[model samples]
Target: MKAKIFNSEIPFYELLNNDLSGGEIFTVKSEGLKMTEIEMGDYPEYSEFVDTDAFRDILRAEREKLRYGDSKTVRISSFNINKSKGVLEVGFHPSSYSVYKAFNAIKHYPPQIFYRDAGHGLYEEGTSDWLDTGITGNLIRANHCGTGLFIDCAGPGGVRVIVGMRPNREIIDTHRLFRTYSASGSIDLDDLTPFEGVLREAREEINFEADASQIELVSFGYDSQLGYFQFSFYHRSELSFEEIVTGAKGAKDANEYTSLDPVAFSAENIDRTVRDIAEAPWEPSALWTLVVLVARLILSDGAKKGEKSGVTAARIDDFRNKLEKEIKNRNYESNFKIFN
Candidate 1:
């Protein structure tokens, strides 16, 4: 798969390979991108935060309340290959940490001890972490799978992207950053396979029912920064933007999203959207997912037709050139290797 970023068309797998090769040390420096750096000493309450003996006791009690035999585990795996040679370069599993642990680690303690407790095998045996530590191992360790949906709608104006607003504040705040229309939590121990999990999330989070026929698998890969296998899907909506908004409004109470926002995907407006996405407090995966989606859209058939129109093509090329320069100046390094 190829993605058009900023105007440059790049192979999708190459981006993933570069990202994974960078390991946990890679960072994106751009305006509007919000990255949280945890410094334990900066917070005066740091000492009291880690002392969760009381919380641990509560978690222990909570475990007793769960159904018996709830501590099941799942093995997660992903492999990268050279498309040209059809040679498998690497095959690996996600990091060893549980989903709950990774979430709490990023969100911090005290305010989100619920996740930490869940991570300690109180809720499940092995949940996958959202962030990858970039450590490689041969063992098939327990991990989770996450799904992201990219909903697209075409109208008189142009294609519009629909994303969900996460309602929960105590955990990962969804208000600031926009997420896929629906996304699944850690899939470890779940009966549903990773693809099933994606469809399930669409129904639960957006009240949008989708089946295997309606959803198309756009990309499936590992994000080394966020240590989980991510499956991205594309669903074309027959409903108009107004109808979508109406449906979402009616189902707001039943879903995790408080509301839905449809952003127009056009060369004229992409810069603003990119800035908005960067400024918002978004999930790391959501950010990268949008980047990939935008790239794909730019290379779509519709975009190709627009290129003949002159105006749209010029706008897109300008954007791509700008992005290419930015990436070039950054000197981003990767360590990906191919094995013969």
Candidate 2:
């Protein structure tokens, strides 16, 4: 199989130039839906997190127990984009590990950097199954999963997206963790699929009560460098802006979110907010997932038929251009080199 590439602007396509064959390319689709999985070869150059003394000590203590091949954790790194149904599905299987082991073995590197770098390279070159044989071992490649919801409310003041400010005590504190977010946690070992996991998280994190039918899966993909899968969900709430605020506030104590912020999804505001998010400390998957949803929404019919179509179109374009630039700059700074 030849290398394949898919992104916000491009449609899913298989067989890249017909130059390679027989290699396992995990791009699967069914029933007018598309999914792609890219294997990120060992990324040994990223030392932002591994270089810490604390990380080293943790690694030293837990290295023996966290050996590769000790347990095969299978995760669903799946992204389903259904244009006909107007939904994107990103889902991941949950797994569990000791908190102490995770703290020491896991790196706090920005996930977006790894995803952007690894996804770009994998898209250009076919998948490879090389594991890093460095001091960090293959621990960085452990399969982790999480769910994020992009809540959109369309009312008198146009469309707004709900965002949550993470509390300081949490692992990713202060940074926004999507509207409502949660990791797979101990529930990964259960029979729950990625879709069910997100639904559970939505209820626990934001008191969001919607049948699975009401929510649509947009797109889902895996980031190999980060050794994790991110499942993103799109939910359009019937609640009024005030109701959403009140409901979200009530659930604040149930989750790690410090406060709820509903951001106007105007083009200008999106452009500014995305730029700010790139600069601020943020959950990488949440930020990128939001970017993907914004790109999809701006092109949807709802956005086009809105009262502010002209302004929305112009602002969406601007936001897209700026976001592309941001991704490019960050990729460059990440110094991600693809090794064959």
The clash count of every prediction, one per candidate, is 8, 13
**Poorest lDDT segment (10 consecutive residues) of candidate 1:** 20-29
Instruction: Give per-residue lDDT, candidate 1, residue 229.
Output: 52
Please give, for residues 1-340, the per-residue lDDT of candidate 1 as tens digits: 2233543433222224223111111211121112122232333232233335754454354445443323332334334333344233223222222322333234334544443343233222232331132322221222334567767665445556555455444343222233444444444344334456566665665566667556654455543333345556667787766665555554533445555666555544667555444333334444445554554555453355645444444544555555455544444323211100
* Model 2: per-residue Cα lDDT over 1-340, one tens digit each: 2112122321111111111122111221222222223232332332334455655665566656543322223333334443446444433332244322444244454444334234223232223322111111223344355455666675446655545444434643222233333222222445244456566666666676766556654434343333344555567777865676567555534555556555445543566556544443334445445554564555453355663556544544566567656655555334422111
Model 1 Cα displacement at 78 (Å)?
Answer: 4.2
RMSD of each: 13.2, 11.1
List lDDT for all candidates, in order.
Answer: 0.43, 0.43
How well does candidate 1 match the true structure, expressed as C-alpha RMSD?
A: 13.2
Candidate 2 Cα errors over 4 Å, as ranges: 1-94, 99-140, 154-159, 170-187, 249-255, 267-281, 301-317, 324-340
